[model samples]
Target: HEPVPTEWTRTTCPYCGVGCKLEVGVAGDRIVATRPVIDAPSNKGHLCVKGRYAHGYVDAADRITVPKVRHDGRWRSTDWAEAITLAADGLRRVAAEHGPDAIGVLGSSRATNEENYLTQKFARVVIGTNNVDCCARVCHTPSAAALKHMLGTGVATNSFDDIEQAKTLLVVGANPLENHPVVGARIRQQAQRGAHLIVIDPRRTGLARIADVHLAPRPGTNVPLLNSLAHVLFAEDLVDRDFLAARVEGVEGLAAFMAPWTPERATQLSGVPADAIRRAARLYALERPAMALHGLGLTEHLQGTQGVMALIDLALLTGNLGRAGSGINPLRGQNNVQGAAVMGCDPGTLTGSVRLVDACQRFEAAWGVALPHKPGLNAVTMIDAAHAGKLKALYVIGYDIFASLANADVTAMALSKLDLVIVQDMFLNETANSFGHVFLPVVSSFEKDGTFMNSERRIQRVRRAVAPRGDSLSDAEVLCRLAGELGFGDQFRHTCAEAVWDEIRAVWPAVAGISYGRSSRHGLQWPCVDEYDPGTAVLHARRFANADKAKLEQVDYRPTTECTSEQYPFLLTTGRTLHHFNVGTMTGRTRQQLLRPTDTLDMHPYDAGQLDLRDDMPVRVESRHGEVVLPLRVSDAVAPGQLFATFHDPARMLNRLTGPVRDTVTSAPEYKVVAVRVRLA
Candidate 1:
């Protein structure tokens, strides 16, 4: 017999938001090799550990190759037609008995923009409900809310390519080295080129080891630290007076609010020295063309949005906006989380952040359906509503809510209470195991054709490298078929991914000109209105999206809700690692599991010694919500009273120990700080 012929395809990585372009070689329906494209704008021929080796999971033995239906609390194999019919009937029955508002649809950040657009359309046009959302609600909702309110857009103000031109870089609350290795490498390269680096994280991360200044403040104390920096800028006269006078507003309100937060007070509160605060402030203020970037650490708190607003205030005060080398950038966690949000996965806004009424009118003209007028429930609110017996049915796509939500126990109970649950993913995830009535298998990024928007808002193509395994279908195909079953057959006549993108272009003006032809060589950024018009790399060049000037919000410091108590003596924080991602569904199935086989509780030497806990000793961490037992690893990365852990392990169930405290404005649960007690097993 002759060996199968090989073919090559170009696509983007599926792991992080760096969006490294790759050339994949396939043979006989298998992905043989993946290499980084030398001319790719984001990575430039660099591939991280996950991106290089995580493709093995595409052919894993445990993948779901057929659809399944739950009967008598057990999943049984079924065909696509049967599964779609069962799911459609279940949803219709629930909506008929209850109201249209009783049904909720949960989209996925891991999916593509075309699939997300179809999912939301199906929810609004077919189900006639606005209860739609994605995992961004738990991760970057504060970023979206705060950035839009302050700078008129909820995205990065500048591109990652501008990092090399910056004179100084201020990274706050994010350990990009472990989470986003490609961007981390670029930051290191910029530092080597004489760019001053300042890291603001509680942990002694890789970049912090070589930083010119590392402000290791106490957890959940970002607002005061930022305010103190502003105070120093005002007192030392380091602020850009001309920029403020020309391109800013509400300066008087900011001055009055920041007048009382002195460096000394901030030092006492945040455990960062007053001298260090002053030096950081001076460097950040005096350094022209400085860039600021942050991650979930700055946005997963009770005062998350306020922290983002304060950071934006710093950038505005220092004249960092409307330039090539200076702006505020939020490092998105997932590869397509930004794209999913921009595709109108949120219930409050439509595509391109348009008003609900205006978006409904425009989409009605195009889609020819009556859309919902009011805003619907978010991810957290939908779960709460399900627990209260208000929400009846839920349609989840490529998300495991049980392991991802803050309170896993409560999320599981809510899943068990729902009347109907339809899940679509490559595997039977934790949430599906509890409540999924119909399960549809979907293909991986390597086996699909679509586009994903990176953190820089660059829309990149994801071409199909190989055929999908067995009877697995693409998310768009499944969604279209389900729509046909739900009486919206005429509206959803898309035959391929390109047709869906055509509809997206008709609705979203940001990427109207970005077609498959234009994106063949390299991905294009948003705001590309025409084919001849080059995409925008930097935003706010002349004026902000709202007004000519940016707004400086007046914000104050607020303590975290779960403070240390006599019973719960330590502050527990959750995060990700380099080898594993959220919930560890894909990476766990690959050889990446051997690198870090089990989750561990990280504590400082002082805390471990006081508790008589030794290295590699199994210990139980208990919180008000729940408890989990894992081996302890003593390290100096965390503070004396602080403990850290990751949620990559499903059996360990780290989120079970986290509570339901959330941000006041965005409902983003505070996964950074939790009150817990430790005991040796």
Candidate 2:
């Protein structure tokens, strides 16, 4: 007999927003190997360790293969029809008694654009509520709100491919090497190609090690540092007057707002040298085609929106917009979070960046239902409402509230008080195990056919590699069946993912040109307006979306809500590790778990010496809200008065120590800065 060849299927990585193209080798329903796609535009044949090896989670023993319902405080496996009936009836009963606004739906960042589209549709049309949101509420909501307000778009202005064309790259508050490895590789490659790399972070990350200028400012002082840089651009006369005159607004007021933030004053507050600030400013200004990138470090603060706006001020000050290598970029943390927001999973906006008032009319004409015009509760407010007994029902898709939220105990209490808690995911996570009333088993991305919009706003196809595991269903199928059972069958009668996608294309003008057939050969960046049009690579080249000019805002530095005190003498920050993904829902089940089995509290050697703490010694880290005990690792990466830890290990539960304070503009929790006290266990 001749040897048989394994079948290969192309799909996008399910890990981060880099959207690395992957090739999976399947043999008799089992994934045998994984490789990178050589021709993919974003990743260009490079994959992170999680993207290459995390497929083991698909066949894990704990994979949920059947739907379950709780009876007498116990779970019992059931068929799809009974589960759908129970779920639909539970939600309908809550809506009838408490009003539709009492029911909130949390769409998943890990889900497909089609699935998220149906998620918001089912919430608005079938249930007649605007209480729909995604995980972006906790992550990139500020980036979306601030970027859209200033630059007229909520996404990256230039493609990842444009990084190679830059002369200077300013990276702020993001550790991309550990979080977005593919993009990190590109940044390193650009650095080797003689681009001036300026890293602004409290801790020295991998990129910071090789950066020409590393400004290790104090935590939560990004606004002042960025303002000082802009002041230098003004003081040194390095600003692009022509670009400001042609394509920008509000420049006259910026100088007055930034007057107080001289290089010396900023150095006094931020701990970075004044000369270093001037050097970074000149490099970013004189170096033509300079680009800037930022992450949660800039967004997870009390002044997060202001921090983003300040970075945008720098880009616009140097004429860095509407070009090949220049623009502001945000490294989104999740795979499909951009897609989820663009598909109208947010309470504030409808699909394609349409406001709620306009979306009501457009969606009503398209879906044949009257949509809610009032704004709904966000993630943090929804928990508060549930605790107050105002929110009766919650339908969560692929999110573990207890594990990911700021206060684990409080989130658990709110979920426990809900009349109906429906959780749809691949596993029985902390949320499902504690409070889920009905559990709908959902398949992994490997077994689904859909599209994921990446960090660059590129819509890529995720082809089905194998049949769904056992009785597990795609999220689209579950939503379609649930909508049908809720008497919206005529509107949501789609039988395939492509049918749902076609409806999305027809409704959202930004993605009007995108189709399964068009993106099959390769991915397409959004704003592809027509069927014959090729997707856009750079945004705002000739003009902004709403106006002909981009808007500049005057922002000021604001101190964090929580500051270091005598009782809590240290500041703690949270981030991700290269080996583990967020909350470790899927990566924990794979071989990656063996690479990093537990979480550790990272501290500076000076702080460890002051407390007589040694490496691998157990210690208790306590904040005003909560505490966690973990083994300590003393490293020079952190400042003396600061501490660091990852949220991958559930045992440590780092979010418990974070406060409930959120950004004023977007309700994103301030996870980066928390006052804490460290003691030996």
Per candidate, the number of residue pairs that clash is: 0, 0
Pairs that collide in candidate 2 are none
lDDT of 1 by residue, 223-275 (tens): 99999999988888888999999999988888878889999999889999999
Candidate 2 lDDT, 206-315, residue by residue in tens: 99999999999898899999999999998899999999999898888998887888989998889999999999999999987998888999999888888898999999
List the lowest-lDDT window of 10 residues for candidate 1: 1-10
Model 2 misplaced regions, further than 4 Å = 1-5
TM-score for every candidate vs. truth?
0.98, 0.98
Best by lDDT: 2
List pairs with backbone clashes in candidate 1. Answer: none
Supply the TM-score for candidate 2: 0.98
